[model samples]
Target: MSDDDGLMLNFAIPDNGTTTTANTQSKNVKVRGGRWKDRRILKLELEGRPKEKKVKGPNSIPIDASRKRRMEEKPSKPKSSQSNPTSEFKRAKFTETKGEHGGKNDSYVSSLFTNNTASTQEVPEESKEETKTYLPSNAPDKNATSFAGLGINEKLSKHLTDHQRFKYPTKIQKLVIPNLLVTERDLFVKAQTGSGKTMAFILPIFHKLMMEYKHKIGRESGLFAIILTPTRELANQIYSVLENLNRCYPFLVPGIVIGGEKKKSEKARLRKGVNILVATPGRLADHLENTKTLDISQLRYLVLDEGDKLVELGFEETISKITKIIDDNSKIDETKDKWQGLPTRRINILCSATLQNNVKQLGNIILNNPEMISVDREVEGTILFDDDTTGEVQTNNEHESFAPDQLIQSVLIVPPKLRLVTLDASLVNIANKIEQSGESSRSIVFFSCSDSVNYHFDVFTRDGKKFKKVKDEETGETKTILVSPDDSADEDQDDAELTSPIINKNTIIYKLHGSLSQQTRTTILQQFIKDDPKFPHKVLFCTDVASRGLDLPNISNVIEYDAPFTIDDHLHRIGRSARVGAKGNATLFLLPGLEEGYIDAKLKIVHPREENLRVTKYETILSSAFGEKNSTTKNKFDKLGNWDIHATTWHLEVERWLLENSSALAKASHAFTSHIRAYATHLSQERNFFNVKLLHLGHLAKSFGLRETPKNLGKKSSKNNDKFEELENGGKKYKKEDPRKKMLRLAKLAVNSTSEYNY
Candidate 1:
């Protein structure tokens, strides 16, 4: 009837059923005065059906005697209407059996009609099955547009395109660019390494620079951006990235300031004005101290890359100093009036892979209320890279697939006297294994300490010696080659000299450690990464410093000559080889009881392994030098098993004693006396003496009186007020000395000391 009330209907009938009426209204004609009345009426009826039917009686009711007899013989059903048919049913005729049948059929047909209409008028399948779409809580809304999509200003886009990053924005960039483009707020971002974090802040700084350029804000007085990193290499890396951007853009200039490089040249670059400056905190501070004219008053953006490592490497003090000089709230602002009157207008950005406590504290001091964007934690181990051209993807290699299942991690438990020889032999065995496996050129050897790094480097290089031809006096520039160990001579003579060619040619070795100059370190690392096929096999002797932050693409085997201090460190060492879907092999050499001690100590730090790793015992090259039947061999093996237990017990006892008697030994003099008393007691018991001798007492006193004695007084005594005087004196003496020289000296001293000390 109306649009809202409109309803469609349909009907169906059984094939066996007879249709009643085609049009009910046509039969509703009413007669008035022998003619159809002029009024509309409706009626319902069955078509061509008789109103009534009746059956004729059999002739004379079969009154014959035979008919009556046959009827009587058949069983007859009882008929009752209170034992008799009602006279009212015949009179009314409406209670007939035909009427009852019609009523029941009408009710059944009505239900069938209703069901057929409902079935025919059902909604379409596609319309009924439609569903609403759901999106993740953290994902950007579908309707929202990103900074890049919103017609980013030409200058900003130009800078981004120059860096070859003109595609979609990273999560951090998408969240930060809008806020930074309008406001100057310090941001502290905690993100994984390879998450495009560098470009997040860099893009915004470029945008600000472009805006300033468009507005014709004349040349700024100081650097606009200052980026600090923990190491020289990282600073250089950032510098390289920015330099590439400059090369592509042609208008921007970037400067790098780091240690182990020229300062005057860096200062010269700064005087010329740079849009961005990347530097190590220490070197940058040094430059700031030396060059008063190189002001950073115009510094707008500050970025700390790898902030976790900056704190780890103890650069917090330097970072604080640098920040204090730049920030408007710093006490150093008293000297600001000496420079330009421009306001600081600074915003700090911190990026780190992991947020250590110290790093968080530092960020709290530097950044304002910050927004946090974290990629799923589970997906962190999965490294994702997009192809610039084809947009293909890749994933990291799982450790299980890369490492061999049957490769045993064993420790060659050698006595302290033979530890060096054991290490040497282990290196040789690893080299041989790599060569035999046909992958020696892709193997790496890890050493614990720098000294060991140099030692193994020398040994391996010597073992794989190559000689060049030289002119002989008799032969005048003839090409006569000199063989290693003088192999051209007798065997005894060859062996007598510390020279051998057989051990040399099979392996090429390189050394790596923190102490090496950055140039040397990078060169050696690059060479290792580019291990030539002609060489077939090369060995890398490195300290733990090389274990992390390096992507060695072709390392097939990793030899842990010295066991790692913790399981995480061990995993990181082995992780170097088996990366980005490559199979790798790892072997460890544990000197007998060394495994137990490391395992016990390691469990206190990292998650403990459910079961101990499989370890195999190898015959010590040193132990075999003696006769196999010697009692010394048996005694040595027995001692090796008990060494860890004895050492642990002794360490625990010492720790307990220090904790209990620390207050009594607060004074340096008192701590020294205690050390003497302990040593005297040990000597007395060992010598079976009832009392200490004057000579022994004198020796103990002298040992305790040495300058190095205070370090042996344990943590508490070293941390006490008495040691403060020694620290202060040392600091003041080196206050005027070169900080680098002092740092080197202190590092060396720390390395050499076997005892724990505060300073």
Candidate 2:
């Protein structure tokens, strides 16, 4: 994550986690000296397109001209597949650095197999006791399970296990592999992040090609499979997985094409021919119109990894263009009777961690009767599931981030100005704790945009990257906000003592993100994978690219250096750590001050609103964890907060109503607790400012505005509001009436009076 203008931000920590938006109130609050907006952080990019390029003249040769010539010469190339427009981030063309390694184009390199890729090649046979329609990827006795049971190539099965220790098929892999291998089914899988969806589609499709077509597959069919990913990082991730699996069959040529690198090497690679190609949609589209040697007329497999993100990021047109060619060509291939006895069929598979409407729409256009597979959020199942029934329950809502039971999650609220300092302290605490226990720990720190990513990276590594100078508009005084405190502490700096231990002889930090050149990114990942011979990487600073599909080893902690834009993002970030049944820790950095995190971006310093009920929401997150059943949980908010609202009696009335009702709602599903925690965090992040006069005038009401449940809305309340004295911050303490107690009592009462329950 380096500072650039691609994946960007305009910060305001809203009631929900989102970036690049804020309430444009008329009044501008003053900060330090200038208006808040002037002093606010300006984020350009998070991943790639780190900086805006100088505008080139319209007459100048276009950056993608090399690819454009192929489409012009080739009559068979589809017109719509040619994307002349620039990609998001408005990426300018990049050239290969001098002395860069130009890998061989004609032969497959041994890049996939690491030193220990086959550390344990021999595996025991799978158990016959398991005969479920679906299977868990990892089991308690994973050694007892095998992919061979699912009719996989025994050699392929053995390699997969050794490559990544994928002992058994993940829920996605278990169901998806067979469908792709045996049938003509299209798939739209909505599994939890890190559930092995990449392997599910890759293993089956690649295996089929190696068995049937081999190296000549591309020569005859011209790009047998086209895997489209949203980002270059993801393309590389898919490429790595596919390339390693390609080791099981050397004849299968797998390659990747992305932006931010010279097109010559990729073109040469494609010219020599590639059977399976993983590419970012924009770059692939660029090639479809330009590279004459590259052809997708016989493309059979089209997989959209992170389909939701691709659609959300506005890649619909590009995807459709690629799909259109595949669609048109598949019909031609069928008409020619090429697949009389072969398993080759144009298959469309879309996989996303979060299932949203756009993703479904994308699938509808590309896939025919595509099946979905969602992993359980609370627990990974060990038994079989029905083909029609995916076990998608309300409790397993995708809005909540999924962490394995082994991951220990916690949060620390820090003032914005102190973020860098606080990060140091937290790291020291974690390292010291681990050192005392005589254990090694690996961690990844994620940021919202590349600017933040690069800033933190510079600070952590003590790199001399220039820290931007910010001026106080009123005073005209400037200072570097993110300079490494140890390396270049400002003369007037106050927090001189704050510093995180950068690295010792035992530690190494690695950086990975899309903004870097493709070559550098690849080198960083490969070195990270091998843990570098000299400086073994223990910590990685990156953006969300590392969050998806790329499973690095020995990751003990995932740190959200910046609050993620959505709950899914939060899940994916942490998902990088506690992967495949390993213990890890995650810490979310929250900035509640004007000088710090997202809150600082807003124009005004607003106080907390509805202070009383905020307690219950947080307590819900804690208490619900101990409860086994949603209906039986008796947790309350009394122990949650002080429940002290210094307001008129009318405000107390509202608080009472909320407390009495929210408890029951919280118990309706397990996800409610997570929702409550997220809600509370949002409240803390927002500038809390509600009119006390409105409450005194009886203008305040429960279940008002764009709220969720009003408990039998359109009907009158079952119990009337009671009369009470307006005690300052405590209308009625009511004898040990802690929020938790109230929750337990209400839960029991609601369960007993089933007729009165609105849920």
Candidate 3:
């Protein structure tokens, strides 16, 4: 038997008997076997013919003898039932039957011999199962899902997808879609910029628009949705987002109405029955004023983006007006008949990075028990991670100690006249420090007023004058003479040539104030952020105008020429720096005398009346002696030597008295009463301290007399004692010298230590 033939035999036959047959016959062998223990063996086959010979002997092939004997002893083949045996045999031979392998082998044989067809069959099953499991069970397959999956119907889905947004919904979309779909509940969502917050609201409103379009309901002859933004720039941005979405979905048409843009086009679009309107309150209010038939009674959803800024920009009044215009129900008289179609229940949504008290109040009036979502801290983490691309958080401790563990505060005292000079020197020194330390170039200088800003600008420019030019001319003769200019000009030109050109050479410098025309302001601002190829950094010198709602990219430094009056303003100013994951620097310029303004000025003369009285009496005596009233001898108060009468009098009358009454007990004794009265009299010389009354003076007299009992003093003493204790404790916590108080005391000391003779 050959390997190709499907046969296996285990038998014993005679092998030793030799016979030469004249006629040789080939016998066909058929084996009938039970199922094998190893099923894999059934697939094997044998091919090629076996040798044809006759031999008589016991076969040497090993077999189970008992099984073979049993098989041999089994009954012989049964007689055929059909009379035409040959016909039956032919039919049986031709007909297909199960081979020894037990099942049809066609499929297995074909798979083994085929090319890529085998792989194709196996791949789709696993892929299909994987894809099925990957999709969220509650929603349809994300890949095949339309905007409908995001709560937007087919009409909106077409528009949104047409805008090339063919993917899974963003995180904000996932949270907002269902809420907007199910109810008109007010939503407050706080997400970072570029987190797709605009789409979150747009898509849901799109769904509502499509619903209204399809059902031919809720038309109400008015706009359906109104989106209020803080700035014209932001309003335009939101308009663009909706416009793209509207293009994708034919049912939606959004119009933008903001300041510093073409009004006619926007008005025309709005008149054409816009489903959504994105606008700034000021401009939209203007439009509503002119167009009496501008109906918004159907306004269903109101979105206020950057809600904090809207209030900060003084838009609350305008916003209220616009909302009142749209909310006809609020305006209608109770006695009058109700409008034919107006939405009674409107949804108000407000979004902002920060929520202030005014914003909260606005929300209370506009939104109905709205939910508040705060992403400030969470977004900070995202920003930090974004800034740390190398996966290592950078510490800003070396320059400005943001770390709580290590803090160092310094106090600098400079004369008022030298303030500008000191500030210039300090900036240069700080710049040097940054360079030497290889730290980031982040620093800011805070000025107290706009005048100081101009002063510093002038000082800095003057300091940079060594890099400027100068010219010199030689004396000329009678005839025409050509004189060469000084080499200094060439040197300055060379230095200027060597110096690096300003990084933002084409940057437009603009001043932002409330007085600028809206058009001029818009043009300046647009130029500042114009994204021109030639310029990148737009330097803006503003007076708190750019503190809020102005989102500029790549701002590395914030210079506060003046310190903010309040801590909140300080936070807002520094906030302009270190925004959107960028490192920033802030510098504060404080002059010596400037700090004294924050502190109460102390009394200069401790015994002004007594001192003046003594001087007056001396002048009287001098006048009596000198009949001529000599100018030099008029007072002798001036040009007083170290041992002069005035000096001696001041020492004995003021310093010595204060020293004797320095102790608390001594100060409370009867002996010190006269000194207290005299000091009080002196203090009263310039102006009465706290309008001290005779009764108050008597009380002071009694306080001075109570030496034995320290606690016997009235409530005033107790309050003083408590304050003293607090000061003492606070002083101990600080260094031996309280830098702030020391600076103030030093200023007072400087004034007191000066002499009238010197003046």
Q: Which predicted model would earn the best TM-score? A: 2
Clashes of 3: 30
Give the Cα-based TM-score of candidate 2 against the true structure. 0.53
lDDT of 1 by residue, 35-113 (tens): 1211111111223222232322221122455555676798864654433222112111111122222223322111100
- Model 1 TM: 0.46
Alpha carbon deviation, residue 78, candidate 2 (Å): 77
Stretches > 4 Å off in candidate 3: 1-178, 190-203, 206-222, 240-251, 258-269, 312-318, 329-344, 376-508, 531-536, 564-759
Q: How do the candidates rank by TM-score, highest first? A: 2, 1, 3
The candidate that wins on lDDT is 2
> Model 1 misses residue 81 by how many Å?
99
When summed lDDT is taken over every stretch of 10 residues in candidate 3, the lowest stretch is: 116-125
TM-score of each: 0.46, 0.53, 0.40
- Report the lDDT tens digits of candidate 2 across residue range 1-759: 215534333344223234322343223332242334333422222211234344322223233544555546877633341231101111122222222221123221111101111111111222456422222222223543468776678888889778757777766566667777877667766666666778888888776765663233544455778888877667777888887887777777888888777889889989988888988888888888888888777677788888877875678898889777556655435533554433456777787876555665676557765555555443332212123355222222333223444555555443322234445545544554555566666778875444344544544553223234689899899964545544454645322112233534445566665556566677666656564333333667776667766677778778886666455566677777656655566777653322133322321111111110011111122222211233334332232222111111212232233334554233322222211222222223332421111111111111111012323222211232111211322666345455433433333333233221010
Summed backbone clashes in each candidate are: 13, 22, 30
Tens digits of lDDT, candidate 3, 1-759:
426555664433224354423233223323334334222232222112332233221212234655566767998755553422211111111111233321123111111011111111101111223211111111222554445665567655665556554455654556666666666567666543333456667777766655543244332345777898865556656776776765555556677776666777766766767768888888888988886545665567889887766775577788888777777544333312332232346788886544445556566547654554433332221111112234333221111101001111122322222223233333434443444454333233443333223322322331122222224356432332222223353533211111111112222234444334445555555555545343333345554545543545545555554434433344445555544333444443222222323212221111111111010111122222222324667433222221123212221222223323454234333222222222222223223222212223332232222212233222112233345434656744334554333333332232233211110
